[model samples]
Target: MIKASADALVLGAGPGALAIAAALSSENLKVEVLANSDPHEPWPYTYGIWGEEVDDLGLAHLLEHRWKNTVSFFGEGADNPSSKSNIPTPHNRDYGLFDKNKLQHHWLSQCELAKVQWHKGLAQKLDINETESRVTTEEGKTITARLVVDATGYDPVFLKSSESGPVAVQTCYGIVAKFNKPPIAENQFILMDYRCDHLSEKEKSEPPTFLYAMDMGEGSFFLEETSLGLAPPVSIETLRTRLELRLANKDIRITKLEHEELGLFLPMNLPIPDLKQPVLGFGGAAGMVHPASGYMVGGMLRRAPGLAKAIAKKIRDSEASPAQIAQCGWAELWPEDLIRKQALYKFGLEKLMRFSEPQLREFFKGFFDLPSSQWYGFLTNTLTIKELVSAMWKMFVKAPWSVRIGLMGMQGREIKLLWEFMKPKIKN
Candidate 1:
């Protein structure tokens, strides 16, 4: 039996799905969201974003904490983790941590105000045709819509990419705890602390990891040990052990464990969805996660309005084909130029995976040394193909000789990937 119908049905209850639902409803389209979990519940993980991004999204008020300056330490004096001899590089941008409960409430409220309907069920089967798409839930409920959006995140059930291969991932183990002493400066966010003084020399020879920490007010701190990107991801147990050792080396002891984030394992490189599919994909399923940075939330939020508008415009066109509607949404998310830019980013990730610890440090030394706009644009995926190419050239020039050589050695593979992405797509 057909349980419900709407202009659009979004699958998943995560931030991305709810965000798109709220936006679609605001566009005056009947929107319904289906998820196995309660949509109103607070998200389990912490989300961090650049302050400017939150402000641009008009959701700055939801930030639990903000830091005016961010810093990174490159492990200059690894023999002494706490030594002042290692100078930190300052990134001028402000960083903000989201208050999950507040953020969830805000989006839920928006959806409610727009009268977006919600269904609590897991989609068991999806069927699409010319006029409408139908989804069958686990409990024998059926729903149909003009358009279907899969924002079910990285491991989406309905949306599948055409490309298949092993993917590299970013992993971290984190904790929010009250420390007897402050683990980091209250005014600063530590973006990356590569000091390995806590590890034995043999351990240091393994894949490199870094510290990501922020001071929460009143003696509480959130700290994480992270691998920027890796294939066969660095294990949570490994990161946990390193984090404890790193803290012990700095003479920091936890007084109370306020919260523990067992692990965050996100796919850093995944193929973008095949636009020919009848159903659209948003968020992680759409490959919105930055191939190099593993950031998806801010991108999803920033794009929600435009995607909604595109879908709404097509939905209003009674003559528009179902495939046309899906294409509009998919194209809005992954335009050709953006596709090329992602290819470049994936190439960079490949190189990073091959770097030794020393080479990795030297690479970032040159990367951060680039003009703020260039580096910032690269990290945020705001750079155009030309600008990204220019940034790479500048970094190549600025990089130490050894780092330059490593990059040069990878030119063949880089060129091949770029060529593949740049070639014109042949329509079926």
Candidate 2:
């Protein structure tokens, strides 16, 4: 059996894990990554991020498409075959579609240069002591490190699941394909087009979905039918059918397919890993994916460096024990302020998931009507709890009577959650 040790050990090689590896390695710590897949494999998912986030990550060069304005279409008019007025609001925030092909190679090359070790294997078990953490691989390899990070994406074997029942999920299917003409607008992209004409009567029984279309340049555009939050998740078959129907409505013809992006199992409202266990969590395992939007790559990238630095500091602090170090690092990743922000976001997700098709249209109509800061902050997961609550209140005030009534129709669990979120902040 092979045995290895390092200053830190990262499980999983997704964007979150890789980012953590790079960050730690740059800190001059010995870091090794373990995952089942090859490090060179291209990420199948195409990521969209606010342009500024990409710039901060030194990944602006990885953007293949950029849009100055983003628009959201909602309301019954959006679902109309003839009504072109969906009451679109153009936002000032810049959006970019990443070149996933190049991004994987770029990050991988950076890791290599930083001397991050790569171990290709599935992590079967994790063991921790007061001084160090150990990992057992499926191939009978043992790895020990001062700090063990579970950047292992969703469905982690190392991290314990906190939720008893199913967690909320965001599911999507997308295609980068050729068309005779641009299927969507030339320069602008639709972040969420909640036109209902694409769904059949049977499909309408399920939760509402939206079209997330991007202008990829050339004759190709990337299009996705996305379900923002669902318990079991909307199936791929349903999403594909919805996408085809939406394309048909636009009279867009597909010539060739270049790539396919399918996303599933984006867990929301999962428990964060215990910091005192000589383990740390990063990426999805740490609940970094915004509960409302299921967008995480950018946030993960932006925070990874800070997390790495925190770990390095903990290791160098002679007085800090391993448990104390883990606790400090966990706090760095998810501080009290951020936890509050996440709760507000999750509350937004819970509220969003309760809407029916027509109700969804009505709710979103009110949402896009929000001021740029509120709407943008909510979508990008950058809003403070106060900002998110202000946005929610504004949306509630602006919503039609039906949507207002729907907002009040929270179930028992949701009501309990709302109470939990409020009780802590109440002053005597």
Candidate 3:
């Protein structure tokens, strides 16, 4: 027996799921969200985004703090032993940390205003037909809707998976703590601190890791030690030890532990969903994370409105079939241009996996050396194909000889990947 029905049903209660539910409800669709846990609770992890992205989304007011000085430290300069290699290379862009409580409340308020219904259940099975889909919860309650969207996060429950090669995982362990003194400079955000000054020779020989940090004012700060991408993810324990070492090296001591973020693993370069399936996908389920940078929130926020508009159009169409609606949603999320850009990013990730620690540092040195537009465009997924190619060439020309040789070594695989990317897609 169907316990409930709506115009659209969303599985999962993450920000992505709530965002879409709110948007769809605003479009006059009867939207329902199902999740096992309380959806209104504050998110566990801290989310940071480029300030411009939040401002563009009109969400700047949700930021708890903003830092105008964004810096990255690569290592010590070869020419000047005293100089940390480009220590404090300014990104020239502001960064903001989202106020999770406020952000969640904002989305929840939007959903409430639009009359979106909320249900608490763990979806166990999915049934799809030509007109509507049904999801069965663990307690045997069934809910049906014209379209069902799986926003169930990284390990999707309903979205059909595709064959993918080895995936690299981005792992980090972080903490929010009150320090004996200010750890970082006031209003400073360290985007990537790759310097090994704090690590022992043995630790440095292991897979490279970087420090991601931000100042939260009044001797409180958030610090994370991160492995950008690795096949066998670095363990949380390892990262925790490294974080302690990094702090000790700077003579910084923790006065009180406020929050601990453990085992944050993000899988990158996963295959996009098979768009032929009747059930649509959104958020992590749709492979929306940037392949190289592990960023999704800002992009998801930026893309949500358009996706909502597209889904709403199709849902309102009398003749649109369930499969067609799903296809429309998938295509909107993974358009051809973005698809090609993701392929390029995947290729870059492959190369990064093979880089030695020193080579990795050199690569980023050359990478950041590019015109701010190029590097920024690459990270933000705003560059056209031509611009992306041009950016690669510029980085190659600027890279040190050792780094260039490492890049050259991957030419064979690069050619194969490019060939595969350029191949014509067979439409169903």
Candidate 4:
């Protein structure tokens, strides 16, 4: 069966797709969302974002929890106050966790009120033509639209994988549980606690790792052991074991289990969509995730509305052919300035993957030692080229000899990948 046509067909019903769909429908464009699962299903993973991001999206009302400052510690006895190097965020650095249920409900209500259509089925194939693009579903239904957008998470079927492969992966396993007493302070969030408290000597020597803990209120916590970056990715079992050891060392007994989560991201730079095709990619498939932090929700929230407006404007005013209108959307998403930002972030990820355990300690030591604006900008994906270069130079100046040696030891393959990512920026 062929259904009604739309001005836009967005595949995937996650926050990214819904945000765009809602924005487009508000502009009086006919938009339909196709998703493989229940549209109301709650997102399992947690997210942390800068307060400014929440303000930009007008979503401060949806915050479940907030902290004025985030803290990080590094090196031996990091858990002990006396023997560790610490970095307490500057006074202005605030972070918050979203209330997933309320947030999704808000977006869904907006979409419903705007008259956005929803379909439950897997998108199977895409057929692009001069006038419109067609999508076929597993249920044998066809959807034709002036434009097709993909927000289908990490490995989108619509996107071709990069030949250069993932520069690095951020992996973790964690649990949400009730404790007799809170494991962390009520008002603080632990960004990265690198103390080696519970591990045996052998386990301690395995790799450089840290714990991410946040007080979720009401005598509960979201706690996990995370490996920031690895080429092959740290195993889930390893992360689990480390988390268990860390919790046991703290004598934090779980009274009841609320949920479990696996955080996994293979950070890579995606190729820009060809303007000749009537397709656009958003979210992870479009390289919207921050390579350094593996955060995308805030970035997508910021990008979706602007992109929707661009597409809507093209449809109303371009008077150009459908293919040309699609080109306008592609260009809006990957303009030259955005491309340069992507290259710089990808290069930073490549540099991060070169550190050994000892060098990594030295690395973060220097990282937290930098000016607040520089470190925070790097973390938030808000750094300009000038700020990035300034941060790098400051970091090199403060980095230990071991860290410097690691930087100088960049191998052939990594160098090739770095060059490839930088090639476009160089030309421009």
Q: Estimated TM-score per prediction?
A: 0.95, 0.91, 0.94, 0.90
lDDT of candidate 2 over 1-428, digit per residue (tens)? 22236878889888888878888888988888888988778776778898776876788898878898688777544455456655665767789988877777666777898788888888987777666678889899988877788888876657664335557878888898998767777877888887766567887777888889887777778888888777878888888888988888768779999888765556776655554455778888877888877788888777888988988988876555556667777889877667667666666677777778888887877777788777777877777778878888989988999889878887736765666476533110
Per residue, candidate 1 scores C-alpha lDDT tens digits across 1-428 of 22226889999999888888888988999999999999987788988898888888888999999998799988545555457637788989999999999888877888999888899999999987777889999999998998889989899978877777768889999998998788888767998888766788788789999999998887788899999788889999999999998889878899999999999988998888777888898888788899888777788788889989988999988766667899888888777788878888988888888787778888887888899889888888888889999999999988889898888775435676667567835221
Q: Sorted on lDDT, highest at the top, how do the candidates line up? A: 1, 3, 2, 4
The deviation in Å at residue 319 for candidate 4 is 4.7
**Residue 161 CA displacement from its true place in model 1, Å:** 1.2
Better of 2 and 3 by TM-score: 3
TM-score order of candidates, best first?
Answer: 1, 3, 2, 4
Off by over 4 Å in 3: 1-4, 77-82, 411-416, 424-428
Candidate number with the higher lDDT (1 or 2): 1
Per-residue lDDT tens digits for candidate 4, residues 1-428, read 23328888888877777777777787788888999987799887777787877987789988999888577667655465554344343335678998988778877888899888898889999887666778899899898887788878767767554345544678888888898667777777888877676777788667667888888877778888888766777888898888877778777788998988866554544444343455777777666777677787787777777888988988775344456766787787777656666666766666666665667767887887887778877877778767876898888877888887776676635566456445643211
- Higher-TM-score candidate among 1 and 2? 1
Better of 1 and 3 by TM-score: 1
Residues forming the 10-long window of minimal summed lDDT in candidate 2: 419-428
After superposition, the stretches of candidate 1 with alpha carbons farther than 4 Å from their true spots are: 1-4, 78-85, 411-416, 424-428
Candidate 2: how large is its RMSD?
3.4
lDDT for model 1 comes to 0.85
